[model samples]
Target: MASSSVAGEPKQSRPGFFKRSVQFFKDAWGELKRVRWPNRKELTSYTMVVMGTCIFIILLIFGFDLGISYVLELIGLR
Candidate 1:
C-alpha cells in the first residue's frame, strides 16, 4: 500500500514559556474588555438577591435538621 503520510509538511513547535504567558494575558484582557460590567446599583441588587437566596436555603436546611433531630430523639436514638 502507498504511504498516506505527506513527507514535507512543516512541523510546528510549541511557543516559549514567556511568549505563552504574554499571549495568555493578552487573551484574558481582550475577554475582560468584551464583558458587560454591572453598574453599582445592579451589583448591589444582585448581591442582595444572592444573600437572600442563601439565607432562605440555610433556614430551610436548619428546619429540616431540627425536625429530623426531634424525630431521632423521640425514637430514643439520640
Candidate 2:
C-alpha cells in the first residue's frame, strides 16, 4: 500500500542526468558513424586555400604597418 500510488503500482526509476548524457554520447557516435567524411585530397586543398589566404592577409597587414611606421618616422613621432 505504501509503494502503491493512487492509480497503480510503483513508479520505475527514470534515467538520471549522467545516464542520459552517456546515452546521448552513444547516439551521437552512431550518427557520426553514418557521416561521409571528406577525402584527403579535398582536405589538403582546403587547407592550402586557408594557408594562402592567411599568408596574403599577413603580408597586407605588414605592408600597412611599414607604411604607417615610415610616415610616423618622417613626422619625427618616432
For 7-57, candidate 1 gives per-residue lDDT tens digits of 777656889999999999999999999999999999999999999999999
TM-score of predicted model 2?
Answer: 0.68
Per-residue lDDT tens digits for candidate 2, residues 12-78, read: 7889999999999999999999999889999999999999999999999999999999999999999
TM-score of 1: 0.86
Give all candidate RMSDs, comma-separated: 3.5, 6.2
Give the per-residue Cα lDDT of candidate 1 at 57: 100
Candidate 1 total steric clashes: 0
Worst 10 residues of 2 by lDDT: 1-10
C-alpha RMSD (angstroms) for model 1: 3.5
| lDDT of candidate model 2 versus the reference | 0.94
TM-score of every model versus the real structure: 0.86, 0.68
Q: After superposition, how far is residue 46 of candidate 1 from its true place, in Å?
A: 0.2
